[model samples]
Target: MSDEDEGPLVKKSRIFYGSLEEKERERLSRETAGTGKLKDGVKAGIAAGNINISSGESMDLEERVSERQSEVLAEFERRRRARQITVSTDDAEVKACLRALGEPIIIFGEGPAERRERLRNILSVVGPDALKKSKKDDDKSKRSQEERQETWYHEGPNTLKEARLWLAKYSLPRAMKRLEAARAHKEIPESTRTVKQQELHKNLRNLNNFCSQIGDDRPISFCQFSPNSKMLVTASWSGLCKLWSIPDCTLVRTLRGHSTNVGAISFHPQATLSLEDSDVNMVSCAVDGSVKLWSMDSDEPVADIEGHSARVARVTWHPSGRFLGTTCYDDSWRLWDLEAQEEILHQEGHSKGVHDLHFHPDGSLAGTGGLDSFGRIWDLRTGRCVMFLEGHLKEIYSINFSPNGFNVATGSGDNTVKVWDLRRRRCIYTIPAHQNLVSSVCFQPTDGHFLVSGAYDNTAKVWTHPGWSPLKTLAGHEGKVMGVDMSPDGQLIATCSYDRTFKLWMSE
Candidate 1:
C-alpha cells in the first residue's frame, strides 16, 4: 500500500539528515584526529632516549617510572580480582556488603556496575573471611527487617479500615476452606496422587499449538481465559480488547475505550459464570493511564477510573471480586474498591516501577513483581509486606501465586522463572526457562498441577509441578509471546504475542 493510502498508523520510510548531524560528524572527526596525534606523540617519546638528563635527574626519573609501573600492576591485579569475586547482581545486596565492610553504601554518580565493582574491590582487599562475615550480617539485617514488617502498622482513611476489615472477614473463611482442602488432599493415598500427576503430565506432554487467530493490528500485550473457561480476552497495543469464544477461537466482542495501548486484561473471578452480562465482567488498564470496567454486552467501558500519572502495567481481581489491584509505572500499586469505583490504597515500596500483580488464591495476600528485580507479598488484611522475593538478576515481569497458596512464581527479564516457597520464605527452585525474556507465567487454576510460561523467544512452555520439569513447548508465534494462561479446566493453554495474534494450545 502507498503511504498516503495506509493512513496515520503506518509511517513512511524516509531518513532525515540535518545540519546538527553534520556538525556531530565534524566534531567526531576532530576528536579522532586529536587522539591519533596524542598516540603518535606517546610513541615518539617512547622511541627516544633521555640522553640530555643529568645523573641526579635520571635517577629521579627512573624512580618515578618504577612507581608508575607499580601503579599499573596494582590496577591489573584489582581488575583480575573483580573478575574472580562473586558479588551479587542485586543492588541492595551489594550495598549491604559495602556497609558491612565499613565502606559507603553508595557513591555519588555511581551506577549498579560501578557499585558492584567497588564491592568487589573491597571484598578482594578484605579477603573471603570478610565476605562470610558480611553475609552473616546481611542475613541478620534481613531477619530484623522481616520482624519489623510483621508488626508494621500505619493509619489510613476510614474506608481503607473498613476495606481491611472486609478483606479479613472475606479471606478468613476462604483460608479455612483452603486449609481443609489441603488436609483432605494430604490424606489421599500417595499412589493415587502420583497416578493423577502422571496422567496430567502425560496429557501436557502431548500439547500442541491447536490454532491461531489474528486478534489486532498491533501487538497483543496480554491474554486471559475467563473463570468459566468459555471465553478468552486479548488486550492489544492498538488500544483494543477483544473477546473470543474459547477453543473455537472466534471473535465475539470488541471493546474499544482506551485511546492508547492496553497493557492488561483481567476477568472478574466469577465472570462468565455467576456474573451477569450487564454487570462488570472484566477490567483493563492502558498506556493512557485509565482503568476501565467492561461488561460483556457493551463495546464501551461501563466505568473509567483515572488518576495514575503513568501507565498501568497490570490489573488483577481480588478473589472476593470486590477489590481490584493494579501495578503502575509510577513505582506504586493501588487497591481499588469496585463498589465505590475509587482507589482505596496507593502502595509504594519497590525501587522501580511495578510490572505485574496477582492476588493469593485465599485473597489474604497480593504479590507484585517489579522492574527493581524484586517480588513482594503483601498481606491484604494487614496492609503490610510480609515476604520479599529477592533472587532474580533482572526486572521481574510477571508474578503468580500457586492455587495451593504456598508457592509464588515470578518470570523475569533474566530468562528465568523462580518459584518461591512462602512457608519457608525463600526461593525453592529456579527454572532456566526461556532463551529470551520471560514475559508471563501462570499456574494451572484447578490445582497448580502445571505451570505455563510465555517469552520473547516466541514460545510458550508447559512445566510439570513439584518436579518443575519441562512438559511441552508450544512454538508457532512469529514474534515475542507476551502472555500465557491456562483455562479453568486445565485442559487448554492460551498465549498472545507481538505478532498481533493469540493462539490456543491443547492436547490433540
Candidate 2:
C-alpha cells in the first residue's frame, strides 16, 4: 500500500547499525567514560618534607610570617565590615525601621541583635532605594487585592429588569418551599427515617441490569430523560439525537439538525408535560459550535442560536425556561435569554474550556465545572460568583446540584465525586468512585438520599448520600460510560456509553 516513500508492495529491511556509525561509537564511548571515570595524562606526585633552618633564616621566616598574619587579619576585618549590620535605634524603633524597609519585623528564633542585623541588611538594599520602589508597588498590589469588587449592573431593557424580578419572585417561593420540606424532613422521627431508608435501600439494592439497546450508529455522548420521564434522548457522535421508549427500548423519533458530532442534549423542563408539542421542547449543542432547539414531531430544529466561538460542550436551561446556559471550548460560559433572543451574560472565569454546568433547583444559582479542574457557582441574578468549588485534580466533566438545594455534587476525570455544601462553602465528602474517569453524577430526585455516578471504567455506581457508602456498582457496558440519569420516580437508571448503547437498571 506504500506510494511516496516506497514502491507498491516493496518490503524494506529494518535498519540496524554496527559500531562503524559515528553516533553509535560516540554513545558507547560516553557511557564507558561516565561509568569508568577514565581520564588521560595523570601521573604527578609531590614529596612530603619539612624545613630545617639556621638561626638567621628562622628569624627572617618569623618576620615574614608576622606580616602575612597581619595581612590576613586586615582582609578578614574588611569582609566583616561589609557584612556587619549596625543600628542606633531602640528595639521597637528597629522593628519600625525594618517594616519601613519591607523586611521582616520579627523572625522566629531570632534575638534583638539578629533583628537589628536583619534591619541593617535590609537598609543596605532598600536605603539604596532599588528595593523601595518595588516594595511600594507590591504594597499597592496587596491593597488592590484586598479591595473587594463592588456591584456591577448591566444596563438592559425593562424586560431584563422584569425578568430578574420575576426570577426572584419565582425562586423565592420555591426556596421557601424547599426550606419547609427540609424542616419537615428533619422533624421525621429517627426510627421512622431509619425504616424509610431501609425501604429505599431495599429498592436500590435491586438496581440490576434490565436491558441494553444499541442507541445510535456512533457513540452516545449524553443521555437525558424527558420531564415526564416517558422518553430517553441520547445525543450521539453521529450528530443525531435519538428518542427511545422507556423500559421497552423502542425507537420513537430521530431529530437531525446538527452537522457535526452532537456533544450535549437536554429536554426542556416543561417538555411533554405542560409545553406544547409544537414548541421548542429539546435543545442540543454540537461540535460545530451551535445550539439548536428541537420539537417532538419535526425532524428539523425549530430555532437556531448562533455566536459560540467554538464547540459547545454543554447546554442547560434555567428552571423557569426563560434562559439557557452553555459552556464552550472558548473558555467561557454564556447565558442567553430565550424570550429576548439575546445574550445576557458572557461569563469568563475558567482558565481552560468549560465542560459541564447545572442549575440550582430554585433557579437562582448555576454551578459550572470546567477543564481547569475547578467549579464555580454563580448568582444568575447578581452576575457575581458566589462560591468556588476547587478540589478536583482533573477536568471536571459533570456538575449536579443536589435536590436538597444547598449541596452540590461534581464528577471529574480524577475518578472521584465530591459533594459540596453551599451553606458551609466546603467539600463535605469525597467518593473515590472509579478506576478511570468519572464521566457523570446524578442525584436521585426522590429524597436527596442517593447519587448515581457513571465512569470510564464501564460501570454505573449507586451511593447512599449521608454516609456515601457504595450501594452497588452495575457493570454491563463494554465501553466507557458517558452519561447517566435516574427516572423522576427513582425506579429506573439509564446509562449511555461509548459502545453505542444505553442500559437501564431496575430495582427488584
Candidate 3:
C-alpha cells in the first residue's frame, strides 16, 4: 500500500494493532480458504466494490470511521460527567433551584425526569458555585432534621429523674477509682508488664478443650461465666437456660422461664460473691420479648421484666448492679431499673437490630454493636453517645470493653475483629481473625491481657495483648461457635456452639 493512501501516521498507528475480533475472524477466514470457489467469489465481490481486504484505501476509510467514533465517545463522556454534577432530584427542589438561578422553572409539558435533567444541564453550564446559596439553605435544613432525629426525649416515670440523679452520683466514684487503678497499672514497669504478658501468652498457648457437654436439645444461643467463675450459664434455642458448675461441667440447675429461644444471659457483677442468693442473681432475655431476673436459690424467675417489643439479643448488668442494659431487635436498647422493675431509658440509635452490648468496668459507659455495621458508645450518666465505632464492612455481632477502660473490641460478620482506642477515638487495629462470621468477643475480665473470639468457623481463638498476636485456636466444636467468655481470673475459657453443646477450655 502507498504511504499517501495509508492516511495520517497518527490514525494509522491507532489501527496498527487490529482489534481482537478482526484478528480472530481473519484467522478463521484463512483457515476456511481451501476451496477455490470461495476465493473466486471473493475476487468477484472485491472487483464489484462489495468487499475490501486490508487495502490502503480501505485503511483510510477505516481511520475516518474510527476518528468519528472517538469524537462521539469523548462527547458522551463529557455529558456523563456533567450529568453527575450534584443536583437535588426532587421536582420541587429542581424548580426552586431554577428559580434561584433566574431561569424558568418549567418547560412545555416537561415531566419530572426531564425537568431534573434540564436543571442538571443548566447547573453544569453555570458550575457548582451557582448553588452556594441554595446549598447553604439545604445544609441548614439537614442539620435541623439530624438534630431532631439524634435526640428524642422519652418521658419515663417520675422516678426516672431520681434514677438519673442516682446514676450520676453512683458513677462518679467508680469512674474515679477505675482511673486510679488504670494509673497504677500504667505505673508498673514495662519490663514487669511484659513478663506478665508473656506468662499469660504461654498459658493461652497451653489452652486445650477439655470438656464438651451437650447443654441443650437445641443450639445454644449464649453463655456467660458467673462473676466468681465457679459457675457457667448456657442459654439455648430450646427456651431454657442451664446453670453448670465449671471445670466439672455438672448441671447445677435448669432455669425454666423463657417460652422461646433464650437469646442472652448475664450474671450480676456480684452474684455468688457478695450479692444475696435470694436476690436477682442472673438476668436472661428471650425471643419472646421477655426479660427475666432469677435468684440463685430458685429454679423460677424472681421477677419478670417486660417492655421489649421485639427479641432481645443481649442483656448486661451494670458494675453497680443497680441498672440493666438490654439490646433488642427493634433497633433500640433500654436501661432497666431493677429496683423499680421498669425501663428507665429507651434509647434508639442503631439503624438495624442491636445485637450485643457490654458495660465498661466503671459502669459509666456502654458500648453496643448492631446489624447496621456500626458500634456506638453511650455515656451512661449523661445519656449521650460520646464515641462512634466505625470501620467494619459487615454487621457487628459482638462488642466488649477492655479492663483498661479505654480499649474496645468488636467482632463482626466481616470475619474480622477490630480494637478501638477510646482515648484516641478511632479504630486502632483490625484483626482478620476468622474464616467465617465472628459471633462473639470477650476480654479477660481482670487485666485485658488477652482477648477471645468465637466464630461460625467452628473455632475459638485466643489473642494476647500488646501486639494482638494469636496465641491459640481451640478447634473442637462440630458446628458454629455462637458465644465465648473468659473466666474472671482468665484461667479458663468457655464456648457455646450451635452443635447443641458447650465446651470448656483450660490450660493443660
Q: Please list the residue runs of candidate 1 whose C-alpha ends up more than 4 Å from where it truly belongs after superposition.
A: 1-154
Candidate 2 residue-wise lDDT, 78-156, digit = tens: 4345355457559998876666666678889998988877766655544536445656777898887656332234566
RMSD of 3: 16.8
Cα lDDT for residue 28, candidate 2: 50
> What TM-score fits each model?
0.71, 0.74, 0.73
Among all candidates shown, the one with the greatest TM-score: 2
What C-alpha lDDT values do all the predictions have? 0.88, 0.84, 0.87
Pull out the clashing pairs in model 2: none
Off by over 4 Å in 2: 1-81, 85-159
What tens digits encode model 1's per-residue C-alpha lDDT throughout 1-508?
Answer: 7757775533422212235445655765675567667666655765685244435352344455457557655765665565578989999988877777889998899999999888888877678688788778889999998786443346878899899999999989988999999999999999999998888888888888788999999999999999989899999999999999978899999999998999998999989899899999999999878999999999999988888999899999998899999899998999989787778899988878999999999899999999999999999888889999999999999999999989999999999999999999999999999999999999999999889999999999988889899989999999999999888898889999999999998887
Candidate 1 overall lDDT versus native = 0.88
Among these predicted structures, which one has the highest lDDT?
1
Q: Pick out the ten consecutive residues of candidate 2 with the lowest summed lDDT.
A: 39-48
Lowest lDDT 10-residue stretch of candidate 3: 56-65
